[model samples]
Target: MEPDTLFVVGLALGVLSIPAVVSSVSRGERPRIATITLMIAGTMLVWAISNKPGGYSIEAIPAMVKRVLQGFT
Candidate 1:
């Protein structure tokens, strides 16, 4: 699987589990379906809006005076 897909899937599953665990601790709910659902939805929302930009760019650096002097005849 692609890294992005893996990330989204993992995020969804992880978000889903948070609420389930929370409810289990408080009201003794076996499954916090509502909270988990909401969290998962939120994760998807963010992922949809934000994606990795393609390609890469390199930045040029200034030549140091020391290096320039060393190369002088």
Candidate 2:
């Protein structure tokens, strides 16, 4: 898929998931830490998706890969 297409897909999914996030937190159905983490992650994903930096761009890939590697080590 194209960058724009992927971005739209990510943005749509992120926005659509917002309601579930609220419901999950409100009902105390999931752990607080997990819910909070999801919100934070979703927020970042939404920003990346909506902005013009573009999906999976060269600049983004390095930073993202760095973060992932850092997380595991």
Candidate 3:
């Protein structure tokens, strides 16, 4: 898979985990899976950023996401 894809997936996972963690806390349960998901997301983001040359810029993420999505359809 492409680094852009990894970055997009990581970003999505990170965003999704937020709600899961919040719900878990509200229910007085451990955020076990949610915490793990967040950790994996962070790792993916770091790996993707490191693998890309010169690293990614904040401005470049939207275009990167667009390109990755285009590949799926």
Candidate 4:
């Protein structure tokens, strides 16, 4: 798999976990699952960033995601 793909997956997972964290906090419960998901997302993001030659630029993110998504079809 591509680093850009991993980056996208990590970002998506991190975004998805936000609601879970908020819900858990609102209910006075620990964000155990959300915390785990965040950890995984962080790891993937780190790995993807580190493995890339020149790293990533904010401007290239949209193109990267588009390429990754297009590869699936």
Candidate 5:
């Protein structure tokens, strides 16, 4: 997959994991799964950012997301 796509997927996963982490904590359950998910997401995002040409800036994320979404349509 493209680095941008990977970054987007990782970002989405990381965002989704927030609810899982919250729910797990609220239920008093071990948050192992949620934690692992977050770790994996972080790794993917980091990998993508590191491998991307010219790297990326936080300010460019919105434009990157827009470009990626446009490609899907």
Candidate 6:
């Protein structure tokens, strides 16, 4: 997959995991799954950023997300 796509996926996964982490904590659980999800997401995002030419910029994210979504439809 493209670096931008990977970055967007990882970012989305990381964002989604926040609710899981919060729910687990509220329920007095260990949040194991959420923790793992966060770790993997972080790894993917970091890898994508490091591998991409010129690095990543916040300004390019919307276009990147649009391009990725277009591929799936």
Best by lDDT: 3
Please write out the lDDT profile of model 2 over residues 1-73, one tens digit for every residue.
Answer: 3334344445455566677778877897864555555566566666656664534665665565555546557
| TM-score of candidate 6 to 2 decimals | 0.93
Question: At residue 24, what lDDT does model 4 achieve?
Answer: 100
Checking candidate 6 for backbone clashes, the offending pairs are: none
Per-residue alpha-carbon lDDT of model 6 for 1-73, expressed as tens digits?
7888889899999999999999999999999999999999999999999999999788888888888889889
Model 3 C-alpha lDDT per residue in residues 7-68, reported as the tens digit of each score: 99999999999999999999999999999999999999999999988989999889999999
For residue 48, model 6's alpha carbon misses the true position, in angstroms, by 0.3
Q: Which candidate, 1 or 6, would have the higher TM-score against the true structure?
A: 6
lDDT digits (tens) for residues 1-73 of candidate 1: 3334433454556666776678777886666576666667666545633553441122211232233334443
Give the runs in model 3 whose Cα sits over 4 Å from its true position. Answer: none
Give per-model TM-scores: 0.37, 0.44, 0.94, 0.94, 0.89, 0.93
Candidate scoring better on lDDT of 1 and 6 = 6
Candidate 3 vs. true structure, TM-score: 0.94
* Over 4 Å off, model 4: none
For all candidates in order, the CA lDDT equals: 0.51, 0.57, 0.95, 0.94, 0.93, 0.93
Q: Candidate 2 regions off by >4 Å?
A: 31-73
Which of the two, 1 or 2, has more lDDT?
2
Candidate 1 residue 58 C-alpha distance from true site, Å? 20
Error of 4 at 13 (Å): 0.5
